[model samples]
Target: VQFSDSVSSLGIPLNRIGTTQGVTVSLQSCTNGVIHNSGWTDNGWCGLGSRMFFQSTGTHTIRAQVREDGFMIDQIVLSPVTYLSTAPGKLSDDATLLAARVPVLTSTVQVGIGTNPSSGSTPLSVNFTPNAKLSGGSLAAYRWVFGDGQISTQGLPSHVYQSTGTFTTTLVVTDNLGHKASNFAKITVNNPVTKPGTLTDTFSSGSLDHSKWLASNEPAPGSISGVNYGSFVPGNVDLSKGMLCLRLQQQQGSSGVMSVGGQIQSVVPYSYGTYEWIMRTSSTSSTPNGSGSRVSGQVSSGFTFINNSQTEIDYEIEGGHPDTVWMTNWTTVNAKQYTSATLTAPDAGFYSYKFVWTPGRIDFYLDGVFVSTHTVNIPSASAYILVNHWGTNNSKWGGTATVGVERFLYISRFTYTPL
Candidate 1:
């Protein structure tokens, strides 16, 4: 039995009740699928005494069945009483042959709010689209609350904010039956500001600036793959000919199971900034046992690291697909990962890879051309900049390196400017 009540407490009646334990009843609030257990009670099998409190006043479903044999029921009693005490059964006067009827509504309303160009200069033009997921319901209207006191009835409208601040945007969806659901997202705006002086290094001095870079030698977390392996090799980082080289090589071990790579991290942590780097990647040519070419499986990446792997943004290039670049954004709250479209890589030569990180968004660019923008799960903490080339056994990411083969990624220049 399913019904809606403005208040809690319900009266029920059962007939042909056995002396033994009768049926057990279970109720569920369909709104959130919460199950409420109502234990066995023998109050003459029909009374206003068996009262159950609903956690909420929405639609509910009730089910009853015999816990023992020889138990039967005829009908469920509906009461107008807001509260019920230990009242005696009035079966003959209150019992009915039918249960109260309520409209069978299985539909639900859901809304998702998304914005384009989520963060930019003041007076930013943003198009808000309410992605509505309506199941078995007739949508009557869409109400958009822009968080700025402005309202709109249009389903999907483009609104331009003429201010510089973070705004909470919400969308409420209503069904014909007056049921409503809402979802919210944040929009950030900032006044255009000049670039705050950049720190650039070209590695022409033939040695790492120890004050700015740190050599990281730690075990890569195993959560990404099934096994935890790989460590930083200090010898692999070479500064020669005005280029910083990160080399990846398979370590000495039985069965070709271990490998080592190079990693470098900036000593200074950054919060919101534009990070850019010019790099080209290459691997040694090879043929596996004279049959097919064995391509190197190296992961060359530049990214910002806050505390964990879950709170970072990355610009990664894999040796398996030398011409493809991947952009990723992650948040530690839900461990949600947002990835961008497959960006075409340069055919030959070093290319510019950059990402602008703000309070509410992160934008990716390749060779000074806009690649993609991600507005969800933006990080808001200081993070150190890192660059590395590594080999992983995880074939999905970067295949394990072949035994005794070396792969290298070169960075001609790197720069960062606070925004």
Candidate 2:
């Protein structure tokens, strides 16, 4: 018999069922022009190995001649050296059955799942990737369960979360040998506030609107802008006297005197817009002076913020300078431009403080009068609108707080009109 294939070796399965005579065989390699002879005698079943050294990988031929009649010869197997090592003898009449009886070595399949942007506001888009590893087998299939009643058969998939909830995404993979592996990842989605073309809040309802605002609650004692003695607590914010009040209070704790501040931020973000606040600071001075009755050592601010990027635009009134309102804009925390705008009566009554944020510029106004304009470091990213009242011990900035005094910043109205 002659055979031609693209292999480096062959496995010959032979069986002797009813004969005791030995069989002589000769294997001649056409490429190497070499002939090798061997005798097979004591074989109920066994795979005889032969090697052919071809200089390159291409078609080659081998010829086999049998010198006996009583011995039975099964099909010759074209295989590599590694496969022929485990090749078994004739197990059945089918050639495939003979190869199937060989024991194969394989390793466990491992699947790892990965997701990008795992948490965000709806409708959030997330990208998922799978890392599959296996030895002695190839990956055959991939299955994904997106945790939203949706399934996929793709190796890499992107999913959109339309509602608000935490979801567990799963990936299951199978190898060519039917070995399976699975992994999972968790994703969180939040409902975002609806964006309005124009908005107005008067605080006349006597309660903070849950749909529009979120009061800041920093219960951990920490510092902000070097004010190390206090934290911003949600309890310090309230609706009273037909206005939104942000209060600052001081109390003696085990560590010593501690302060609490108040803050509220808009739920939806704004980009180019006109933002306004009709507000006034609390007065500790009994006599009204030309500089107004604003208390020293406190800060009242209305600003726009992108927390992750540190982008901001500010209108801050520092009680240390009762008559000055700092107007500022920033592209980053390290990049900023600011100026002081003098106010005639910052604590006596409610006055409109507004900022017109447009492309390339931010124009500030106090009591509807144009105060200043900043053309440098104007933040281009959308940010949340926020107002806060707090006290600091930094004398040059907010000054040391009066230990027993309770301060407040009252806002009667706030509005935003998008441009």
Give the candidate number with the greatest TM-score: 2
Clashes of each: 0, 0
Q: What TM-score against the true fold does each predicted structure earn?
A: 0.49, 0.52
What is the Å distance of residue 47 in model 1 from its true position? 30
Q: Residue 305, candidate 2: how far off, in angstroms?
A: 0.8
- The pairs that clash in candidate 1 are none
Model 2 lDDT tens row, 149-224: 9889987899898999999999999988998999999999988745567879997797899898999987422344
Error of 1 at 350 (Å): 0.3
Which candidate should be chosen as best, given lDDT against the real structure?
2
Give the lowest summed-lDDT range of ten residues in model 2: 36-45
Clashing pairs in 2: none
Per-residue lDDT, model 2, residue 251, is: 62
